[model samples]
Target: MNILLAVLTSAIAVGGTLIGSWSTYLFQRRTAERAEAVNREERLRQERLAAFSTYAAAVTELKRGLITLWFRRRRALRDQDTREELQAAQLDSDRLGAAAEAAAFRLRLVADDPGLRPLMTAISTHLGAISHAADRQAVIAIEARFEEAVTAFIDAAAARVQ
Candidate 1:
């Protein structure tokens, strides 16, 4: 009877040890999974921030190119050299515009907020109108709109990153 009691005690101790080990493993796995999920979210947030900044920078560059083109066209010089220079500027402006569009598309892909698309469209429309501005006043008005759009985008991006 004593031998049987000893065996029973030993079996209970082994079973308790197994239960404790299993519970510890489950708890550790859950903790690890939670940590991994947090890390992944952080990484995605960082990627979105980078995409927003890149899109903003690209838009700024394209705006600068368009303004330059507008000024060059306004000069209305018809000499061969002037015409060549204007053509080159136009090509450069086109390239910058394409780059800005590509950046905007990338931003769209990563943006978490649904409102960003309309803001982006507004910016693009303002940018397109800049070259067609008839006078300094028109340009100024378009520029104001452009600046507002840019500010709105920055604000939205800041909120998202936070």
Candidate 2:
């Protein structure tokens, strides 16, 4: 009887140790998975923030170039020297526009928000229209629209990143 009891006790002890070890392993695995998920979310948020910042800076620079181009075009009709300036302005504007478009595409790729596309398009459309404006007043009006679009985009992006 004593021998039988000792063997039974040993078996139960072994079974309990295995069960405890398995439970600990499961708990640790779950904790590691949760940590990994949190880290991934943080990394995505950082990427989105960087993309949004780059897009904003590129768009702002493009807006400045487009406005300069508008003034240069207006002056080119009356001044011979302004024609050269206008050509330079045109090149700058083209380069800036391409940069802004690239930034927008990057932002679009990183952003999960669907509404951002139209806002981004609106800004680009308005910025493009500035150079085609009939007068300074028209350019100013388009600039205002561009600012509004940018504001909308920034607000939306801010919400998404948070």
Candidate 3:
């Protein structure tokens, strides 16, 4: 009887150990899953932040190029060599605009907010206007509008990542 009692106690202890181990495994698995999910979200946030910043920088570069080309066009109207230089500047501006558009597309892919699309579109329109602006006054006015749209986008992006 004593032997049978010892065997039963040992079996109970073993079963309890197995249950404890299984519970611990399940708990650890859940914790790991949660951690993984948090990590994924953080990574996505970083990606979106990068995309937004890149797009912003590209837009700024394009704007600067357009402003430069506008001034060049005004000054180079009478000079043959300056006209060639202005043409080169225009080409560079075009390239910058294309790059900015590509960056915007990337931002669209990573942006979780649907509202940002319209803001981006508005910024693009302003940029287009700036590129084709005939005078310094028009460029200045369009630049102000572009800056506002950019600020709105930045604010929206900041809210999203937080």
User: In order, what lDDT does every prediction score?
Assistant: 0.88, 0.88, 0.87
Question: Against the correct fold, how does model 2 do in TM-score?
Answer: 0.87
1-162 per-residue lDDT for model 2 (tens digits): 999999999999999999999999999999999999999999999999999989988998999998988787767776745566888998999999899889888887888567788888888788878867998889889888898988898898899899
Off by over 4 Å in 3: 80-83
Worst window of 10 by summed lDDT in candidate 1: 75-84
Q: How do the predictions measure up, each by TM-score?
A: 0.89, 0.87, 0.91
Which candidate do you rate higher for TM-score, 1 or 3? 3
Q: Give the TM-score of candidate 1.
A: 0.89
For model 1, residues 96-145, the per-residue Cα lDDT tens digits are: 98999888888878884787878888899999999789888998899899
Q: Which window of ten consecutive residues has the lowest lDDT sum in model 3?
A: 74-83
Per-residue lDDT value at 64 in model 3: 91
Question: Backbone clashes per model, in order?
Answer: 0, 0, 0
lDDT by residue (27-82, candidate 3, tens digit) is: 99999999999999999999999998999899989989888887787778756446
